[model samples]
Target: MKKRVKWTLLSLFIIVVIIRIILAFLTPGFTYESYFHLRQVDHITKTGFLNYNDDLSYGGRTLIFLPFFHYFMAFFSLFLPLTIVAKILPNILMASITLTTYHISHSITNDENSSLLSAFIVGFLPILFSTNSFTVETLFLPITFFIIYVFMNIKRNTNNSFGKSNSLWLTIKRKKYLYLYIISFLILSLTSTLTFLLIIGFGIYMLLSLMENKKINKEELEIIIFSLFFFLWVQFIFYKNSLLQEGFSFFWQNVPSGIITEYFPKVSIIEALVLVSTIPFLTGIFVAYRSLFKLKNKKSFLLISFVISTTLLAWLRLIRFKQSLAFFGIILGILFAPFYLEMEKYFQKTKLFKFKEFILPITIILLLLSTTIPAINASLKQDTPTEEEIGAFKWLNENTPTDSKILGTLEEGHLITYYSKRKNIMDDQFRLIDDVDKRLKDINSLFTTHFQTQVLSLSEDYNLKYLVLTPSAKKKYNITEFNYLSKQCFGLIYDKETKIYEVKCELK
Candidate 1:
């Protein structure tokens, strides 16, 4: 009865998650990270294979990614429209990874309720644009979990002993496991930034490997070398050429600097937490120890080192930007799972009181979820962000002429340029310009009240005609800037909080 009930609940939760996940692709920002990625797919559908060029950019450009995602989207795009087909592909594919997490965690612990908890937590935890937003992180991060699941399952099964009853299952063919691991890693390395991340993750596993197991077999070591070789080779052939062409040296250039120093750490905090808590918190305490001991071998010291390296990398990212702490914690928590479970068992046998077992479990569960809630909130905030916003995008799409050169605010500029098919004097395609930040600052100042005072030449030189302004920008500036934009731009369109206007006109 308990098994049936738990399965039923898990099924229902999965159904709900699938339904809600649709919202991730439905309402969304017009443009975001790797925005050009989807645009590249759109071009390929009309054109041919990747004519990968960063020269479309005036600023320095670096190109990474083997265009696997674009190719993946191209396959699905055969049936669907370009934008929907390209944008929604990543989100849909990752749902499988979530399912993998639930199954993997459940199998490890042999706790049906805990598995259900894992699935619910994974499905519902908000990840800002990642959960739904069309971006690389959402599409790729879940696959890492799925890959880890495969390793764990293989480990679990191989540990079976050789005997009359178990011989059928305990075949422990080292070559087969080696091939699977190598192939999985090689394939994944082509798709995204898995190279650096998996190194950190597997390093954690190596720690576990050494703590109880002997030195890695030749086969396993060979698998590791092949995976590394493939990852580096792919980058060399595809990403490296593009960067060198653009005066770039390393792969990080492919990832914008602002992304790493400014945005990533901040965003990663929320992203890491949601992914970490996909498994229930307290269940590890009651179930993880048995599995850990069962898996522990002469090579346990290797496993310890792996755990320490992964923890250290995660901490490095966190110290650079503290949000990364959640992922580190989740991983360390998993590493410490053995102790947590042993303690749970010890306390249960102690039997301090009738309700103590229940209270302790509930307390731990609450604490874990709390750690991730801020990230969830952050994700939700990114989805809509602010209310008093025009996203001039909607108006620019509907109202602007096809070829009109207009000035738009940073958020809405790219939207108008892309969706409206207009030639913007400046758009938020940062890679397209030499001075990305300077353009953003100048464009932003145009919306404030004092926009007229700073850039009078824009009116005459750029033929600045149409303008889109949102309350969000108005509020961002102090009294001086707000007053300038309000007085100068003739209100061509206004409704409730949103406004649209032309700089050249006087309203009737």
Candidate 2:
């Protein structure tokens, strides 16, 4: 039975990898945001350092971020092409969440089949279906869950050791997990600011224990305290300049107030249910409500704490939309184990007990179908650059002068820098830019307004030399053609599905 479970888990991991690799090949290049990380990896590979002072992004601005994920990609790029490393490595790291989910579910349910089902649910989770997103969260999610698994084992070992004869061996095992948890957490902290979600979840867990008149584990309390201080110190070291410069507003990452709503939009219940799948969303919520309110199921409180933390932070608009949803989906996936086990146990007492064998397969099939469609759809629908767009950028790289600056929408900013090898007036990295809000307004006016004089004045102010007008930009500004654009001022340079215009008329 154990060997069967092991092989099944291995097969599940491989299946996920194969699916994602196939989906990645459906696009010519990665999503727009991936080019930024690609550029960072390229720099790290060439210069052996991160380009913190990026000259091309936002037209020469200092970027503040954690560098561990970039270094991670750079390490693999030492042997292979950076593009291959980007497409394959992220999917593999993301798929490893299956292993972590399996262990977490097994620990809670003590049933291998139920745990396998949990792994399958997470492997195809719709919110995690971005096969082309080369972001820190790919590495961050699996590491965070591995830390949670290690932490869970530590608590379980401590509980099981009470009055046991092999106490010394148990003590050694607990120490091993303790070291593993700390190491995994350090990696997570260096990877992204999302580490705060775990730290905050720990706080909520302790508070829930106290409110319930339950004693918190001594080791858990000590480790939570250590994590809190260690996380603060590490963040201070990396973001000291921004922390002192922006003060309390640093929590917002200095995002322009005008567009903060877009970054952290409120996720509706229906939207979240569709992303996480209807069964797991409903089952997990049921399990959480039962655990907290009636059954007082302390065993599931740790997972429930995360659900609460993610919900609270998301509600407060502290976490970004997609990230919050992804984390929520993972926690709910792990929680499904307990709910499935309970259902299995309860069914054995009813007349449906005769049909128990059929139930498991049917439920698994339902989950498989529910999540698979959304996963494939999400991967196919990724906002990657088309072949025509790449051709335009390559032409600009070959034909344009070295000092040319390209104007694109916020989404196309990184693509302009990476493919065209030219300076971009703005990109999504909003940290430490004093004029971010003004830049956003100006970009909007340049694309949407009908005033030619305003466009020329703004163009000269930023030293804009070329402008890209793609179908996306047309849809964004709700204009089929720029009425103010004429041959005297905006000379069309490269024309295709994606067009580029050279800025000709100078402001007098």
Candidate 3:
């Protein structure tokens, strides 16, 4: 049974990685935001440190971020190109979600087949198939789930030996799983601020357990307290200035109110069903309801709490849409194990038991069809730089001065810096900037305005020199060309699908 489980996990990991890599290699570059991460990794590989004082981004700003993810990527880039590390390592990390989810499912259901199937469902989850996204979340997701699995096993060990006289520290020292949980939790805590999601989930679980009159495990409560304080201290150490500046808004990462909606878009029931797939969505909901009301199931309470906490945060506009949905979808996939176990139990007592052999295969086929199609569609539709855009940026890098500030759409900010090796007026990193909304509006005006005076005015204030106009920019600003272009001020320099214009006339 252990061998079967190991082989099943290995097979699912291979399949997911292969599918993701094929889709990823379909393009020459990754999605726009990936360039930001690629640039960070490259800088770290060269200097053995993060570029907190990034010279190019936002035309030179002090960046605020946790360095673990960048350093992790940089460590691998020592042996390979950063681009190769970005493309391959992220997919491998993402694919390990299968193993983590399987262990989590098996811990809950104690049925290897159901756990393996759940792993398969999560491995191909559509929202998770952003194969080209070289972001922290790739490491964040699997490590977070692994931490949860380790935490759950700690609960199991505590329950099995509650009356033992050993102290908690002694128990942790004696049992390797306890040590593993602490180490994994430390990694999760440092990986991203998203670790707060788990801490919040733990709080909610305790509250729910109290409401239901369920007996809370003392060891689990102690661990939760440890995790909470430890996580808070780590975040404070990293984000002290951000916390002081943003206050409670730090929870939103200081994103401008005007664009917060873009990051944390509301997900409707229908949209969510499509995102998480039909089977896990419906079955997970069923299990959550049954566990909460009918059975008062203590074992399932933690998972339900995480699902609830994620939904609550997403609804409150706290978590990013994709991040929340990924968490929600994985929990539902694990919940499917309990649903499957229940269904199998029911089948054994019913006359329809003869058809049980066909159930897992049919479910797997349905899940694959539901998930794989959307995954491929999303990968194809992902907004990445074209060959022409890459060519234009490379030309800019070679021809332009190193200190040149290029203005493009917000999406092109990282692309400008990464490829052109120059400054961007503004990019998506909005953590500490006080004037993000104004910057965004100015960027829009720079692209959309017909008045040369207004263009030059904004450009002068931003210290902008060059402007890039691409299909994406034109489409974004709803313009055919810069209507204010003239021989006196804006000189067309590099022209292709992407156009770069040098600002010639200085406004005095």
- What's the lDDT for residue 11 in model 3? 86
**Model 3, range 347-453, lDDT digits (tens) per residue?**
88999799889888887788879877887787777778787888888899999989889998888999899999999888989888878889988988898888999
Q: How far is candidate 2 from the true structure (C-alpha RMSD, Å)?
A: 1.3
Cα deviation of 388, candidate 1, in Å: 9.7
Q: Candidate 3 has what TM-score?
A: 0.95
Please provide TM-scores, in order, for all candidate models, with all chains considered together.
0.69, 0.98, 0.95
Superposed on all Cα atoms, the candidates' RMSDs to the truth, in angstroms, are 6.3, 1.3, 2.3
The 10-residue segment of model 2 with minimum total lDDT is: 158-167
lDDT of 2 by residue, 1-508 (tens): 4899999999999999999988887767988888899999999999999999888887788989998999999999999999999999999999999999999998888899888888998999988988989988899999999998998888888777455578888888999999998888888889999899999999999999999998877888899999999999899899999888887667887778888998889878888987888888898889889999998888888988999999999988889988898988988888888888889888999999998989788988898788889889888888777888778888889999988899888988998889999998888888788788899999988888888999999988999999888887888888776667989999998878888899899878
Task: Mark the regions of model 3 whose C-alpha exceeds 4 Å error after superposition.
Answer: 161-174
Better of 2 and 3 by lDDT: 2
117-179, model 1: which lDDT tens digit per residue?
A: 454444444432244355544445555556566665556556545678766545545445545
Would you list the C-alpha lDDT of every candidate in the order shown?
Answer: 0.50, 0.89, 0.87
After TM-score superposition, the amount by which residue 481's alpha carbon in candidate 1 deviates from its true location, in angstroms, is 6.8
Task: Report RMSD for candidate 3.
Answer: 2.3
